[model samples]
Target: MQIDFSRSIVDIVLDHGNSIPDRTALIFDQGDGAQSSLTYAELATRITQLAGALSARGLAGRRIALLFSAGTDFALALLACLAAGGVAIPLAPVGRRKARLQNILNMLGDIRPDCILLDDSMAALFGDELSAALAVGPVRYLEFAALAAEPHPFAALTLRPDQLAVLQFTSGTTSNPKGVMISHGNIIANEAMIQVAFGHDQDSHFVGWVPHYHDQGLFGNILQPLFLGSTCVITSPAAFINRPMFWLQLITRYGAHTSGGPNFGYDLCVDFATRRGMPDDLDLSGWRVAFNGAERVRPGTLDRFAECFADAGFDRRAFLPCYGLAESTLVTIAVPPQSDPIVKSYDSRALAAGRAEESKDREGVLELACCGPAMAGAEARIVDPATGAALPDGAVGEIWLRGPHITAGYIDNPAATEASFGRLDEGAPFLRTGDLGFAAAEGFFIVSRLKDLIIVRGRNHAPSDVEQIWSELSGTVGQASAAAVEIEMGDTQHIVLIAEMKRDDARALSDEKVQEMAGRLRAMAMERLELAVTDLVLVSASTIPRTTSGKVQRKQAGRMLMDGELTVLAMAGPLAQAFGPSEQGASAAGQSALR
Candidate 1:
């Protein structure tokens, strides 16, 4: 397949529509044995029709908010927005939660989109809230059916390389979500990078369940396959979460060549297999590239998943650990296809002190997964965040990137854009990832987010390191999640370990058992991480807040803990004194503290 790098995605789609009209473009698994698909000709027609309608409404070059669930409609809406020469802002469908509705409203306000494309279901769900929010502005509400059903003749608009294509909102794990300005050039360059890195071709097939609102889903799952004019099978994140096996089932059903999600996804699959067992007909031999990214890639997750699915012909070498962000337009560093993931054990103590010293001994060592070298046409540098000087290999520092794939800046936020995207002393522009890591000859190793790092008594600890310890200890109880956050109390920063126990475990375990588990967590943190846990709180499952991409929102969790928003099943340590005696008391105390 010959790819013209000079053309925009819109042009490429049109070319594919003409050349491979009967080729399958997308297959959506409904997760209930029902499925639907579209050919290149059908996809192109829908996109063009919708685009013509949008253009007729004078929405060109305007921001259009796509508020639809992950499915064929959302995909069509997104492509139409881009085809119409409008900036597509894909947001998750609004839910019943007032807070969630407000967040969507807040985002809409920030971008001030000219129109919102949704479906009847979404309108019925949050019509009142949306109406009230948009009543204050001139934003138009356009339904997907109404737009796609209208017949309109349209010619594809030629797009410039630097023209803004999409406004990708950050997950807001560390701070308020900012819209990353992704240009047409960035998309084309990134798609090319992904093609070379993953060894994808026109014949390559994809099966993905990651939400389209996420950068990984939008770029890696949706656009990457389209760029190669290949078939892509997609399912909703909810479907995957409800049954992790469905994801593998789709890959097996379609003999998918590429598919992946965050590290937690791999863990979920391992858990599912352990509990329910894999189907006898399951076969993953054709899955050539299982790219893991959008969050910290865990070595243990890769190991467990490979071992669990080994019987189904899963290849460990196919595991590709990647590192990327929306700011970089999806992927920056990714392991080469068919290569064994690099896992090096570094001295935990040395890592805490800003160095990646290889540990010969197994004890007290952190196994870091190497998210391979910079993508083609990209350069990665490890620099001291405080000093702005490039650091030597094996020294932990901020990861900076420079490449055509890198986004221009945040939308309408000059302050943040200035802070994150800037030029180096030598006049080369780079995007500061705000992630702490060290680069070795093999590849780049991500340590932790700069904002989420827990500093205690002059020692730095990654929350993931501590959370991993808790996860291992709590596995016997049930499916548990942990959040290790740093909270400031009277001029001192303290580590608060919050564990979310599965509902069954929370109900079955006595207070004594919960306290024992908390004590074990503290001891493990001290022994393994050399850090003292100031307080430990045990809460019911789903207590820890997470971003849309399933990353633990440590900053938000920390704030929630301070504000007493988390429901405490049990508390350990001195902090318990603040929440006197009972669960009800803790809630009242938290409310009072806020006042």
Candidate 2:
């Protein structure tokens, strides 16, 4: 069942509708005991109907945002946009807060979509803000139900392979969001690469709860199944967040062959299993490929997940640690099926010097998991950030990639497009991933981002290192913590700790307790990292800013602190003295690097 890459995805799906019309294409769980199923023929017909309505409305070549809360509606609307020759923009449902709505407005200002597609329920949920937002821009709203009921004759799709198919908005970890311009050919090439990398076919069944608005969710779960002519069982992201067990239950019930999410998702499952335990009859023997992507893959998280579920016939070898970004259209590197994830140890000191030396002993070592080799038809290289020269294996540098799977550029942002897609000295085009990693004989080891690395006294420290130190005080500090830096006069930089207050600490707020916790944190920072903490700001849970993929927005956090937006529960150390270490504190600080 080889696919014709020249054909549009809509055409491929239509071919499936003709050859295997009765096959279950999509199974969506509503999370309320209600489920929806769509066969290929049924899906093709619905897509044709809605596409006809869109084409009648002259929406071809326009940008259309899909904002449905229901997975079924979302899938159909996305396909209809493609079939109608319009670029699809998958957006999260409108939130309630004014700030959230303002964020939506800001994105829309950049996108300037010609129309918005959503269901009636979402229309009601948006209330007056939807109308007001529409009034501000030249846009129209189309209800899915109404569009499906239209009787316009179906028109032939006019999309070309080079034409834009989607505007995938980045998670905004570095700055404001930018829409990655993904062409139809980019999707086709990546889908084929994923199939080759993951060993996916029509026999594979996928069960997932990652949000469809995300890159992993859109490319891995939803589109991969359709591209392979397979069945996809999907539930809302809220379902997994509320109860991660639901995801495992779906995999078990559906005999799903592939599934996965970020490292935090596995941590959540481990935490749930530890507290509530798993069902005695749960069976995960059919689960084959468990992909861990979209974030850092912690070595401990993999070990714990394996130990927790080994009793239920879950195989540790099924773990597949992978890495990619929206700029690459989803995945670039991935572990092959039926192989165990690669884990290695490196000297932390050498890593700061842009080298990856295998640690002789466990002491002062940093453990990293391999994200596998480059996918088929894709090539990756390590380049020195300062010199733009390619680095040899075992030398940490920026990850550069080149392949047909790479995206075109950002929409309406030539400066960003040029900056990210600059040419190498060898006269070859490569995408600068902005990630720090080193290639080894086994695979690539992803280190912290170049931007997220903190420089203290001319020493490099990953934010995770600082956050891990602060979160060890679990009783007083929450599990989530962010490490930020502020630069003052004389080119001096000082570390700032922003963390959530533990539930008990927030409930029993007192100046003495706050000061006590702050003092302990400062002491621990000095004792462990040997760095003087300038200030410790304790905030409520969910106050610290984070991207959609759960990565901390350190730059944004710094801005909030400077603007006095964060409610500070406690403050320690003199702000001005941060530039110059005090003699009293310097005398107390020891020589250690997070022992």
Candidate 3:
């Protein structure tokens, strides 16, 4: 069924809000450790009030920036913006708010948002620290608390289905960020896809500590729950990052039956569980659909997560492997929850060579896990990344997808937009995802992120290849790690390995001792992988600024290092003197253009 998104997302919310006024629509944790509840009626009222405030400021049909941390206000404000027929751009509210703020400002200069909405405290912070956040000049601005205080007023704002809803910016590999313009129709399509994929109903409840700014966090945790009239338990991403196991514990505590995250989340669960172990009385029987999406789903991580949580009533069948990206709003495919999660293993060489070769994954060790077929309207295909020729089954190539949920194009970037949308060859056009993968009857295998691939000396080396070696080190690092990548001098690729002690103590930084650890990593790369490293940057466990979804922004990490903010620099004694010869050094790295 086609949707008339002309009514805007607010219309959908009002429909459900009126019908489910009594339902526990939103359960949020007040940062101070207290819990707060907002029913459908209450949230709708908040949206109306916020929308009225925004309307008073003439924000309709204009682009608006939201700089927020997390919690109830963030959700309501986003929905309110949708209702007001404004294009919402949610940005990271952490870090030197100025740096991210300036980045957002630069983007707005291109798209030209009319107003910027920021945290009540952050607005004050910028007002006091204006010089620090120098990019502020044009555009109106509003603080969070101020908008909340405005009176509620009914407004009839219509939005076409294809009208831009949000500008979700994804970081470029070596360039500035690009914003994907998600439409109202795409939002509807993805919500329906997620609703169908999860096989849930109004009775379903979703709980999460995922960031509201991320596509997965916003789609799975906020939009899906609110759109379906399901109960949602929300918490700060910081709370979860600080304690990842709380994601699992929350499922048991609130009887939330629907949830998912990236592979690292499950791995973290295993890492935490093995060291701390699950609570003896933990009950995860209520979890009906525990899915993993938004990032590469590793098979080993899934297997170990099952092993660690087996005693806590966690069922392997509850895990559902899936695939998605911001271009699709959120979901593209999701396997139905099963009793025993299955992973299809293929010989690594055969996969890279664009052919199928079955392999035995050590009796119990998990190998490959394929994301299922396109959900609902989406169509998935494999095309050679370079030639744009469609590949047959069992052949590896770039993954191309198109459906109702696919974004129209990147905001304000016609070149990138046209280039990314479709490729023409032999009179056929297809969206080139840049991702390399292939289909295998039941589902598709996603090899890796296209942008993250490293082309060193003509050989493609996945950063994960080396990072895995460090991550798997015995009795050290654990899961608390950060891998920032930068091209060194002379066009040589350099990876800065950063890991803080699990105990989170600065005294743990014994230079010579950590150098000894770096030596172990250097040996693995040189002898086993034939790679040279320039430096190792070690920081406290939380120094690395991730996307709250565990995605390491290498550029951000490099900036931290260049600014002399790094905590520890561990360089292999050999390359320490050969920095001038590295390709990423001096002029080579700075002059090289991004592909």
Candidate 4:
């Protein structure tokens, strides 16, 4: 499993094609019992042919935007672009949604790719939109099918370690999207780290549904398998969202050894099983490493999932809570395979004060899942955000990382690059991840995003902690996705809770009943965290926006609430005045009674 840093991943593809041409390299599950697979020979041949075609077209060092859905086409396009010495910009296929399409168009305008690569089917589907994209700049469209039809003789291009391979765009949950420059060396180093940390080899199998545009899906689910010359089974994100059980079924069918996604994916599976009941024949014994990353790994989610599927031969030790971002090229910290996730209860007040204090008692405690130590050849440190002084263990601060896997910086944005990637006190270069966490003996425990921290009366309250507490208390709110944000009112900062209620619950509750529930939530917040909930706005389900990676966009939610963009089902407290005049009058009369 030793990775050769001297050779690029393109070279590995060629080697695999030559040595194990008959072995299956990739499989795409169509989610209806139908699947497609490609052998190593086919993959390498296609990549070489398409790469040759691209190079022959004078696109050796140009930016190519891949706009294919998650499938063999996307995988082939990405590898071929890299092989041809072109910068690959993998983007999710923009469907009919205007907002999503506009977002893609905006990104394209910023990147200004030389050519947009798509399959024949995709080009036909988005024919009109593709026409509109031409207005952004002088960009040509290249179909993979057309490129593959005419194969040209191609010689492997010499690649440098620092050569840019991918422009991974951040999910933009907290800010506008910026492309993270991932070098060839960064990918190789991170792949090696993942192979060692996750205990993967050629015999290992992977099945996942994370979108290939995301780093986790592209690197972990796809490239990592290629790195080990292993088979990887992939399905679209829609397939997994439509039926979470299909993800589990794929693992069962493939006897996959490594596969996972964000905490929400596990939560969905658990919820699906809870309502429909788990199938008795399903077995997950072969699942050795179920990594949870790209978002906070909730301990409750892990516990519920393990208990829910225990009868199906699912092992609790298979859970690997990890922490990473696109800037790291994929994984930075990951728990070893077959290790039980580390969970600890810390005093809520101490964590709020930027220090971790272990608490044995059940009252006023926050249970956090530990994202294990930095991967091999990587170093992680917690430093005070204000002074850049390194903090000792148990002190919550910004997590700084230094490793070969760490990407250089954001592309075309030197100010952002300078601000994010810097040396700590004249030491080695480190990526100042805007995440807040602390390192303990076990590993690192993420608290919240430094930007998402809700401050009220000068005390830092992690929005995740508040959201979790609200979720536990809000019974039958139906898919309790809550966003706790700080809204400034007349000379005072107020803690506002915007939550989603099921359609059934939203229609069944009377105005009086909604007020009562809001009052109870406010009372509970006061009793539990000693923080007053200034307002509670209940909206329909899926109202809150989330990044493609499933991280809640707290900042965007606050903006929507202030802009009156959200459709409110019910409201309580002073902020209710923003909803309408009737609510304003009602709130004015009943605000005192509720308080």
Q: How accurate is candidate 1 locally (lDDT)?
A: 0.85
TM-scores of all predicted structures: 0.96, 0.90, 0.85, 0.95
Name model 4 segments beyond 4 Å from true: 1-3, 94-96, 132-136, 475-480, 581-595
What tens-digit string does per-residue lDDT give for candidate 4 at 1-595?
A: 3446898888887789999999999999966767789999999998988888999898887999988877888889899899999999997664456776676677788998998888776777765787676845688877778887876988888878899999999988788879999999999999988999888899999998999999999999999999999999999998998898989998999999999998889988988888898767789999999999988888989999999988889999999999899999999998878988889998878888888999987767888999999988899999999989999999999999998899999999999999999778675689999999999988899988998988766777788776776777774221238888887655666688888877688778888887887787777676556678888887777778777766678888877766656667777787765456421222332233323
Clashes of 3: 17
lDDT ranking of the models = 1, 4, 2, 3
Whole-model lDDT values for every prediction: 0.85, 0.79, 0.70, 0.84
lDDT of 2 at 353: 72
Report residue 180 deviation for candidate 3 (angstroms).
1.4
Give the distance in Å from residue 383's predicted Cα in candidate 4 to where it truly belongs. 0.3
Better of 1 and 2 by lDDT: 1
* Rank list by TM-score: 1, 4, 2, 3
Please say which candidate is ahead in TM-score: 1 or 3. 1
Q: Cα lDDT of model 4 overall? A: 0.84
Which regions of candidate 1 are displaced past 4 Å?
1-5, 94-97, 132-136, 476-480, 585-595
Alpha-carbon RMSD, each predicted model: 2.2, 5.3, 4.6, 3.3
Instruction: Supply the TM-score for candidate 2.
Output: 0.90
Q: Which of 2 and 4 is the better model by lDDT?
A: 4
